[model samples]
Target: MAALRDAVGRYGIWSAELHTVSPGERGEAAARLEALGYGAVWFGGSPGVEDAAPLVEGATGITVATGILSIWQHTPAEAGARFLELEAAHPGRFLLGIGASHAKLAAQYERPYSAMVEYLDGLDAAGVPASRVVLAALGPKMLRLSRDRAGGAHPYLVTPEHTAEARGILGEAPLLAPDLKVVLETDPGLARSAAREHFARYLELPNYTNNFLRIGFTEDDIAGGGSDRLVDAVYAWGDDARVRDRIDAFLAAGADHVALQIVRGGTPTGLPADEWRRLAAVLGL
Candidate 1:
């Protein structure tokens, strides 16, 4: 846990477009993130560990995580081999974040809990230590597994209240890192619009909807691209002070760290570099 904490501090970025960034520019972006003092960079969109090694090699003194690499896509042997290779080149600077992604996203997705258990077993056999991995867990069963087997849990699209409930379940052992969506705009209408644009696609996913239900969002709240209350609860929107307050609330709710995914006004792939800098200043990091 100490090593994990040292690698990913209190805040980081979970970007879907990071891997898509041009190779030449990706390293520069990573370097800029390090200079801005973000503790970690999470490459989402189900990247393989191989896709992340170049980013690790590109930057210094910052943790690089998968946000989650889907179990169905990468075999445990391949993942473990890549982990070792990356670790050899950059020790204590890479975190393996694995998940049982949505059913619709993978053709072989079935018995996810069992599959994740088996996957972890294979990783163990392949020499990837439990401390080097984190599970993208949402339910109690997976969260317990995260504590018992992996370094911790990395839950996505969660609220502060969910953070508190997850902490209670984890009981202070495993690391609890949740993804928090943020819209930098101060205007309520514009912020919610941005949030909806980022969230509408997710509403169709049962895994996320089920988790939202567990966290107390009603079916109505989940419908129509999510209700205002739902969006407000899930996103940290507004100016720097308001966003910082939201981050503080999550921390106070027992989050070990929060990985913020900034939802910019236009394309989510636009890369909100300026907003990242603003958040760094607010977080004093």
Candidate 2:
């Protein structure tokens, strides 16, 4: 866990867009991110284990991880085998972040806790070390599972308050890295609009909405593309200082690392290298 924490540092970049690009482009972008001093690059959007190959092959120093690979999509044997292959090549540069995923998104989603335990058993049988794996845990039960069975938890769409509660459940040993959305825009309307555009789909997933409710957000707060309070709490918008402070809040609340996913107003895809550079400067990375 200490090694994983050291490799990930305090800040990392998370992008679903990386999966859309060609392998070579992804590799180049990963190398650039390493150059920019990000400790890790998380491949989002339900990527497969092999999806991280190009990133692992490209960046010599930056840690590469699946921000989460759905357990329902890939069998444990396959995921464990692919993880071994990548580990053999890149050694310590790859981390397997797996999740039960959302019920609406996964047809096979049932008894998720049991399924995750079974999946871990299979991974264990297939020679995947528990220390190299992280769970996309949101609820208390799943968070506890992550603490006892895996290296740590990589929670998505969470607030600092949630982070603090998760940390209490996970204790002090396991890694607690949460995904945080960053909107570079300064205008309240523009920032919230972009945040809503990115966050709308997540509202439909009970897993996330339930977690929001658990963390003190009401149904009204989640309705209509999320209330301003909900948007502001979950996303870091406005000036560089404000963004930096928000990210720091997560760390202060017991998050070992914060995976920043930049949200732009126009298109949802693209590398957003310029925005990343600006963030790197502001973060003094």
Candidate 3:
């Protein structure tokens, strides 16, 4: 099948934590996200290669992607079999996202680039197409490797500045999808707190910390949950307009697609109507 490279609005589920939303809720969330004017559903987390079909089972036109499936957890052979099966059944709707997840977390995360390439070869051996996959790349080496190996790159917790750097490294035609967080509240404390809860877990991860440190963030800035400056730079908190401006920043920076992670209460909304309406208008679906 062909790649789903169409310009999907920069808003969808980061779903980096797919298990957070159950199988039943996955489809429901996809429909609601599309209804809310979001273009794609980027399902994430450590779901085994074959574990995500139910996540996008209910949606039709929307593209379902794994922001990242760990290569360590499931062999490429396994992922390929499942991916090909799903693509045959649903053609042009599934984008397989693979990642050399954090090294510390993997049993033996040595040689991430090599591991990822071998995994891709495994998928090739199993009949999965190169155009049907994406990589979770932060640095330039991985970015180049991604272009050579998969369809493009899907970066998480990255700023528009990072997006620009990535775009430069990737050049034209490679898909560049970045995930952005949004807080619709006007209260500073609440918004910051939300950013903290969602981001603190990532602070200790070497992949994230090292990437930020290389980007010029000070050690102080990399402190727990990220300093306010770091949080504000990475998370687009505040009113709808402010968040929209950040989205514009990313697009202007040359990102092909942006997956907006509406970080708020329970569901995507669970906040207020005005914020939703304003965002929908800005997104243009």
Candidate 4:
């Protein structure tokens, strides 16, 4: 667990668009992220181990991880084999993040917990060590599994309060890296709007809404593209200082690392390299 935390460091970048580009472009961007001083680069959008391989190859020092590879998409044998290949090539630089995903997205997403256990079992049979893997866990049960089975939990759409609870369950050892959305805009209206635009889709997912409800957000807070309070709590917006403060809150609440996902208005595609640079400056990465 200490090795995992040190490998990922205190901060990392999570991007859905990073996986949409060509292999050469992706590699170059990954190298730039390492140059910018980010500890890890998480390949978002349900990426496979193969998707993160180029990032591991491109960045010599930065840890490259799957924000989450859905268990339904790839067999554990296939994932484990690919993981081993990347490990042999890059050694400690690769971390495998796996998840059950949402029922809406996966046609076979029934009995998620049991299925996750089975997937981990298969990975074990395929010789993928639990220490090299992390689980995209949300609730207590899965969080417990993350502590007992994998190296840690990589929770998405979570708050610092959730981080505190997860850390309690993990007992100060397993990595607790949560994905945090950031909008660099300063205007309250603009920042909340951008956050709502990015958060709209997630609100439709029951898994997220359920988690939100569990974490104390009311139905009204979840309605109409989320309330301002909900938006502010879940996203780090306003200015550099505010962003840093929100990220620090997570650390204070007991997160090993925070994975920042930049949310820009208009279309949520293309790499936000400038934003990443600005964030690196603000974070003193």
Write the residue-wise lDDT of candidate 2 on 65-182 in tens digits: 9989999999999999999999998899999999999889998889999999999999999999999999999999999999999999999999999999999999999999999999
Please, what's the RMSD in Å of model 2?
0.8
**Model 4: per-residue lDDT, tens digit, 1-285?**
889999999999999898679888888888999999999999999998888888888768999999999999999999999999888888899999999999889978799999999999999999999998999999999999999999999999999999999999999889999999999999999999889999999999999999999999999999999999899999999888999999999999999999999999887667999999999999997
Best by lDDT: 2
Stronger candidate by lDDT (1 vs 4): 4
RMSD (CA, angstroms), candidate 3: 2.9
lDDT (CA) per prediction: 0.89, 0.93, 0.78, 0.93
Off by over 4 Å in 3: 1-3, 7-10, 16-18, 265-282
Give Cα distance to truth, residue 199, candidate 2, Å.
Answer: 0.8
Among residues 3 or more apart in sequence or in different chains, the pairs in candidate 3 whose N, CA or C atoms overlap within 3 Å are 10-258, 11-260, 12-260
Q: What is the C-alpha lDDT profile of model 3 across 1-285, one tens digit per residue?
A: 124567354565565545665677667666666677766777666666455686557777677888788998888877888988888888777888889998777897889988887898898899888877889999989999877877888998898889999989888878888888878777889899888887877897988988898887989998866898999889887766787788889989988888876676433432233454566776665
Candidate 1 clashing pairs? none
Worst ten in a row by lDDT for model 4? 50-59
